[model samples]
Target: MTAVQGLEGKMMNKYGYGTDYYGYRKKFVVLVPSTNTAVESEYHLMKPTGVALATRACVIPSIKVTNEEEFVGLVKAIGDATEQGLKDALSCEPDHVIFGYSAETFWDGKERSDREFKRYNDIAQAVGGCNITFGAQAIQDALACYPGVKKIAVISPYMPVGDNMVIKFLEDIGYEVTAIKGHCSPGAVEIAHEPFGKTRELVQAVNSADCDLILQAGTNLHFAELAGSLEAELGKPVLAINTITFWHALRTNGIPDRIKGFGSLLSEH
Candidate 1:
């Protein structure tokens, strides 16, 4: 054998990861902010047999975000907490990680998103050599599944600054964001508390006949269950960040189960 092969032969053991009878197919570590209330439950609701999720939360002292500056600060807080969250999650030796925060993923644009994903991925590799799935990349991938989709309408639980970031990111990735709106929830925790009626209204307000798909930002905003119904009514895709990210994680790891009722992104794609 070559020198590389000889060294690899004496390397660390592959611990039979994912041999857990429960997660024998694949194991996922889902990283979310402590302020998030939707990711874990939404992911659990969609998990297939033999797939397991271990959720690790990065605690942020403040969930309050009443303005643009505060929202930016919240993103910084999540960034600082995420590294340690990844380290703690590595204890379980998961096969992959799903980053369940949407704002950071959509902060700058596609290129920036790629760099951030790589930053977290490098951490995963150094510790245990696993991979990670990110929201912007996942949303981009989900949109790619529909080759004909280009015109997009977007809704979020952010103010103008955050929504603008998401819109610019979408455009950078080659989608035409025809219209966009934000629920502008007062605080991080309040993002999940935004009532269903307001979101559905925002969906209609942002959508147009020319729109090909509707996108939702903010993983903490509760929209997974509602996406399917919106699609049924609109005759187009409604891609929520959490659902798309979870779908991306499963598909990236080679889990091919067809999950139903969540929208075409899950059931059909």
Candidate 2:
């Protein structure tokens, strides 16, 4: 039998003993907007053996974003809903918390993102009694794995307003944006539906010889597998937001399984 099959049988043997799901070594409580459809699916695809992912939704009443103003407003609403989501996730008493949304991670600028992270961190500590991982902090940690990578190309499914915020945060952290391309996707659900072919085209459009790496932002884009493939073609690191977030969560919880075909962040570091 394969290793996974062996593990599965072992877990079944412990069923009568009242162990957690599959004798999971860790549990991650993920919080996402109600309109989001990608985070949970992607997380499930990449989750390693003995790790369980439990998701909670932050309620958002609508997803009809037509303009930059509406887009920004919707992102703010998602952020507002996270408080309730955090409370719900904490009830599960997970080993770690993961913010499964990305647009809000770039709101305002670095200062605002830091304040927001602190708010979420406090909530996780007080209620969940655990540390949390999110896009902004995860990206920062992922970038640190590649030394001397100063110039980067970016691709996202956000409007100009959101793009500016992402750029601001990167600049604040001392990285130069060589090129950036945004899909300007109409709504939350629509962003999740964006074709992987389009993402490939976006990466090609933004790629430059000066760019040390290519980074994809937007939790709904489903770029983890593609990022791994593209890294071979581009001869530089290609990072997806979900990969970074997952890698951060695993590392933070002291798990290092070296997941492959998802990017260097998981496979190498």
State which candidate has the highest TM-score. Answer: 2
lDDT of 1 by residue, 9-81 (tens): 4353355433544566678999999988899999999988667799989988756788899989888899889
Write down the lDDT of every candidate, Cα atoms only.
Answer: 0.88, 0.87
- Which window of 10 residues has the lowest lDDT sum in candidate 1? 1-10
Tens digits of lDDT, candidate 2, 167-192: 99899988999989999888888888
Candidate 2: give the clashing pairs: none
Prediction 2 TM-score vs. true: 0.93
Which parts of model 1 are misplaced by more than 4 Å? 1-18
| Estimated TM-score for each candidate | 0.92, 0.93
Clashing pairs in 1: none
The list of candidate 2 runs beyond 4 A from truth reads 1-19
